[model samples]
Target chain A: MTIADQVTGTPIAGTADTAVRAKTAAPAITLPVVGERELRLDLFRGMALWLIFIDHLPPNLLTWFTIRNYGFSDATEIFIFISGYTAAFVYGRAMLESGFVIATARILRRVWQIYVAHVFLFTIFLAEISYVATRFENPLYTEEMGIMDFLKQPDVTIVQALLLRFRPVNMDVLPLYIVLMLALPLILWLMKWRPDVSLGLSVLLYVVTWQFDLYFSAYPNGFWAFNPLAWQLLFVFGAWCALGGAKRMSRILASPVTMWIAIAYLVASFYVTMTWYVPQLGHFMPKRIEQWMYPIDKTDLDVLRFTHFLALAALTVRFLPRTWPGLRSPWLRPLILCGQHSLEIFCLGVFLAFAGHFILAEVSGGPVMHALISLSGILIMWGMAWLISWYKSEADKSGSKTKNAVSNADMAGGG
Target chain B: MKAKVLLSLILLCGCVAASSARAEDAVPAGPPACEVPAYLLTTESQLPKTAEIIRDNKPLEILVIGSRSTAIPSSEDSSYPARLQAILKEKLPSEPVHVSVEIQSKKTAEEAASGFVKLMEAKKPTLVIWQTGTVDAIRSIDPDEFRSAVTDGVSALQQAGADVVLMNLQYSPRTETMMSVPPYLDNMRVVAQEHEIPLFDRFAIMRQWNDQGQFDLFNPTRGSELAKQVHDCLGRALAQFVIDAAHVGPAQQQN
Candidate 1:
């Protein structure tokens, strides 16, 4: 019944049989029978990370190619969704096998790690911006990146940074992720017991928050850029799908009607985006309709953006199955690697994006310069991912080899 | 020796006279401080109504709808709008060229736009130069909403029988980092293009001046003097832009 059981390619009835057989035939637990890694998740997540890096630095021509220009939702939606799916996939199993307290502790540990990373990034990002600002003798750079407040009051700003109240530009996502991760245990528990009811409660919360205009107040002004109260819906939705929501929706997902609806919505969103660019198309759009859809708020995660993301996901799932051979191709390996080490790559990306912006701003900003910066930034990210992956594998090998050596010594002593 | 000095002085005078005469025959250049790139002043779009008013030798009533920057706080006469009036009067001595300013301080594009219909009915100017986007960028309003508001305002102005010239946000190196401006700037450009109107790229022109070291925008000590100089340059540039858009040169005037 658990995702872990499903991942091992055993039916509900066959799970007990497989466990009994494993106990009798083998001393240790068996490895997963099926490839449950879901390379699609990693590939998409990796692509999203790269896109986020690109989108963070403005005035780049590549931004025209990003999903934000073409559609309502962007890489942020994809990142949050996959994060939820993976969190549920990993922690759900832990909670089922070990216990609730242990699983909660592990989630808390991840939250702490993410919090530390955020603090580290905040410090480094401020230092980089401040150094550039002073070196170039352009205090505008500091003002431009919203570092003027930090300069005015370092002690207060540092405290605010630690509290996740103040963040410079392009450093918002990590804090949001931290808040979401902090709430995972409770979400996972409710999901385990009452999936539908829990999901209903999340939707209700979203609606109530919107109605009451409730949001975490950001430092030196307005609310959080990515309001956790609202964005938690997407994370919870992803987790639900990880549990049994996808299975429940299998029939609807496979239906031709649903496919056509999703396609139609996507086309509508595409047309709306086109109007933003080509104003000639905008004339044809009814004035009343334009008034109704004037401000599609990204901060609160408007319904249009949410549905657009859903439509996109639907089309993606319809086309790309789990068994797609392209998932294992050499071309996609870099993305998968980046996705596996997302936290490190993401932190690196935020730093790199700012660095790229600095290079473009201070130096020449020709098309060729942009090309060089973009390509080099992504290459560095890929290289970091590869390096981390290699180190992790080597560490795993050594860890297992040490265990084996310890056992061998025990055997010799016994003889 | 006195005769030789007199001869040199006469020669210098002759050269100066010849150059001045040539300048009169050619296009009259602006002051050194007001000099901007030709591309910034030139426009493909025409102010047809303004041109018609010039041809008819009618009173060219131009109303400027802008924020606080439109007027200089220290000296009102040194403001861009006032300087524009002075420049226009000098350029068209025969015609009564009146430039009036209406300050819509601390208002976003949407708010300013909502008042256009009523304002147009009252002012009834032949040309309307709308300076906007600074407040909108400061507030971080939705770009789509900003664009729509601009479109609405432009249409309303056009419908009111006024030629519209959009003036985008001011260029300050400090505020550039504090707010995201490209969206609003791009949206303004797109709206101007869509409506087939002229866009006075104030941001670009100011940036050009700053980059060229014509003005020290970073120095706080310059204060009111700096404001006056920048405004004067802007007014001169805007005057040239209007003249070019209207095609009111000697060649066209003779026709």
Candidate 2:
């Protein structure tokens, strides 16, 4: 029987049901039920996108409200982890149903799509910065956005951009994501064959990269801002959890000891991060120890940052279980919508951040202006998400209508 | 006979010295041959530890900490830090010099300063070249807060036994028109002065270059080549500025 029949306690007649029954009867590899969309992923991912928008505004007062102020990790970590989780959820299903080769193709196609989106975003971002610079007769914007190279050698820079080696400011993350997605097929294959070995390999790479200072180099000079070698550990860990790791840890997850540890870590991280804002308290640590602890290399996904994110994740999972109806509440609908259309919203956010910076600079960038710009930018993102959702719904409706018409005609002809 | 011999020798020596003076005068002094541009130099006090390191022929370590600008691209070796190392190596070939960069990544002076101790511990550079104030200026951060942050950062660097050279905001025509940079620049100067550390006047130097048409700041088509040239010049100027601050010359040693 089909999932729909099982859910509604009614028979769904036709060849589809019969095929599902035949498949179920054979039963060595039972198809997993595709359940309701995970509201928590959408909710949190949306929250991360918003935080990114606010934080990108630079000198804004509202940045204090973002997750960065309270922890070593920030929105980037959240966004990336969620991406890994969702990718596994979607692609894992495809592999189970459509088989390995098709799943690999699907993953590769996604990589291409993300790469295209990244290029498109880069073009628009560069154009926006260039246009603003020209309009104001200030070449500094080009310099500020790290586009002087492109202006100097468009031919070479364009080639580098296509290669994902030349990225402007706020444009680095997409490249990192692209690299991670490129490896998704292998990651999934490993997870399917040997889950523990896959995770072990990911961790090994993370440690090796951090220890040896290994990273992919950007064009001209320097290394990728978000080192993929280090970051892939988190992404892989997220996927592992989505596949079955979380289920294996159910006892530990439910344990009070684990809960307390997670809470304590979060609290301590919160205090330490706050001290960075308040110098008097910040200086309480010994210079030697502080120095050793600091400059926690964000590029390499330093161990402290990794642990902090883990603690935050643990607490989040504990408090907000999968059954938490609060995720589906009207109050969080905007976040859910944005999360659903994450790639589009993220690209839009990058543009809006530049616009916000421009507005803050051009207009009175006081607190009021900061607030206004932030609100407006977020509203625009929400609007874009809503529009995308609307378009998708309309297309789906059209598709269903056509299918229904074809079926009706077939029925009549058969009768 | 002895008096006559002495007078002849003295007369010969005087004539030889006079001819040498005339030869020196005939050679033109072109713009004081300033390896480091005058505009980029400030009257801040010397870097004692840095000088000692250079004078001892020990390795001179410089840590360049700033935003995206800290890592401007042309080639791996073209970054200001790499160029600075090359220039320093050329100037003090006997001394092993290494310049490393730590990107603050869109952080303000306050945020960047918070990580000084960590950077110092990891790199343990003798001299910390802080390129700051741009993000703060753009964000319109409070001058007092900016000053405090800079002061704290300098103090932290010093406490870690590293000499500090505060590099001020870069002059970008676009940024200049958009935000008032004076407050942040002035605050950095105040902090540097209070801390008795050298302040590399990147703003004044870039502005001078732009104003004097040394570099085409207004060129709509200014490309990576110009960026390379600017960074190269900056690297050379900064190397000289550090060398001067560390009191590396014979004149400084005599003083």
Candidate 3:
């Protein structure tokens, strides 16, 4: 079987002799194309993006329903982990079929694209916050959104913004993504040659970052909010799973013993998280244990957070099987669409979050207002995703038509 | 080596000249009464470490961690921390002072407090001016939780050997009408009193300025220009407040 078949878990039609012959004659080797997208990745990623939007707008009542209230890991872990899985699935195939040079070029091009999107998003986000602050005659908005630097020293701040250093508030995640994407080529190469070694290296980096206090410095002050060195472990682990690690551990993944352990861990996390709402019950735990787990550092990807995320992922995969009928339900279509166009949806979500905050502050910010703003923002996101998907589909149809016509003309000329 | 020495000499001369001018500018003989309101003044005992640092001719490092409004206008020289540094330097010309601002992005007091230990370790500032309560007030976080978070943050700063000063919420006419802030403000004061740390009553001070006809904070068109003036005044008041808290005076100056 081809490496693509091995990675994607798709069965090959040809015999072992045919596969051997194809491998010897590179011209005969055809890569196994992924005809269908992974529903689980898209569904969860879309949901996580929406949750991130709601969670960012503080004081909104919608935050209560987010996964964070019931688990140690929040939407951030889900988003980053899915990002890793998707990146590996997409790019690993390129490395296998098109050769390393083409794969490196493609990855770098993607990094550049993400970098540009980040800068564009930052500019638009600043403009939005600044306009609201000025229009409402409230300078506090600038301060609240972390855009005061740009207002004060546009020259220096613009440079820092370009370098992905001066991230204001919600702008930190894109910079983290940019850094991770830049390192994807090396990660893919290592995984291609030595999967275990690649994962080991990732773990080593995370441990060193935690033990030795290593992190990239942010511009005009402190360290990066999401420390890439520490967070890369989750991203790498996701990639490993996509690159045959999941299949290698298929027995363990399906084991009843493993399933029980995941469920138990999730239940415990739920109990612990629920206590946060009830202070008395929160303190019911022993003082020493509470103190040790008091500040689970989100920036450095604390061990508790990592373990909690793994447990959550395991439980999710077990419960929400790939062929679950609900994945194709009309009710879930919007979420699936948003997940399909995640990058665009994420950018829209950031803008909507800022808009939501402004609206909450301007309006009564009561329960009714919060509900209205959240529903409106989410609908807008879904609408935009649908529009983009429609446009892409139309473009694809037109291109295919043109190709077909050209082929017919060539055949007629040969006759 | 020679270039370094020459640069150092130039810097020393510039510092002396700047200090002399600042001393001249420090005199507030003709300013309006509302500009330096009595309610803004703190009679708490001086911060021993701050005073000692100034006395030793060392650069007093002050870290101001708060919302953007309290610290922004990005011109490092115009920020409250920068203004405070200038005010302190004018008061004690021989002592070089540096103020750094760290913007708190977290909305709740607890979330803001979570970063205190990390920041304290990183910055190693002799003084930490924590501006909080605005987000919590807007969100209507539980009063008890807000109190506990403030207390924990203060305790963490103290343990890190940094003097802690809590600054309450900014007075926004628009926000005031929209949400109640009494619980958060009262809780902050109680925490301050319990911890023996001085609470900078920014909300009251701003309210007084509006009530006393010092600044028309309600004016919607002024935007950042008005904010600049208010921040400048706040920086001056905070400088004096810190100096008084530190018990630094002409007599305490290092010769």
TM-score of chain A of each: 0.88, 0.86, 0.87
Every candidate's lDDT: 0.72, 0.68, 0.68
User: Where is the poorest 10-residue window by lDDT in model 3 chain A?
Assistant: A1-10
| Clashes within 3 Å, all models in order | 2, 3, 6
Report lDDT (Cα) of residue B46, candidate 2. Answer: 89
Q: Record all residue pairs in model 3 with backbone atoms less than 3 Å apart, i.e. clashing.
A: A143-B68, B46-B245, B46-B246, B46-B247, B47-B245, B47-B246
TM-score, chain A only, candidate 1, equals: 0.88
Highest DockQ against the true fold, candidate: 3
Show where candidate 2 strays beyond 4 Å: A1-33, A132-149, A400-415, B1-164, B168-255
Regions more than 4 Å wrong, model 3: A1-35, A132-149, A362-364, A400-415, B1-255
> What DockQ score does model 1 reach against the true complex?
0.06
List, residue by residue over A1-415, the lDDT tens digit for candidate 3. 0001112322224446544543554331233344455777878888988988886654335666677777778889998988887777766656665567877776766666667778887788667646554556455344332323346777897898898877766777888987887888899888877777899999999999988878787666556768899999998998888877876777887888988998898888787765543334744666567555645567788898899999888878878888899998999999888887777788888888777766655554444676788888899989998987787556445667768555332211110
TM-score of each: 0.72, 0.62, 0.62
The local distance difference test score of model 2 is: 0.68
CA lDDT, candidate 1, residue B48: 99
Residue pairs in candidate 1 whose N, alpha carbon or C atoms collide under 3 angstroms: A144-B177, A144-B178
Worst 10 residues of 1 chain A by lDDT: A1-10
User: In model 2, what are the clashing residue pairs, if there are any?
Assistant: A152-B223, A152-B224, A291-B117
lDDT of 2 at A111: 69
B69 Cα displacement, candidate 3 (Å): 9.4
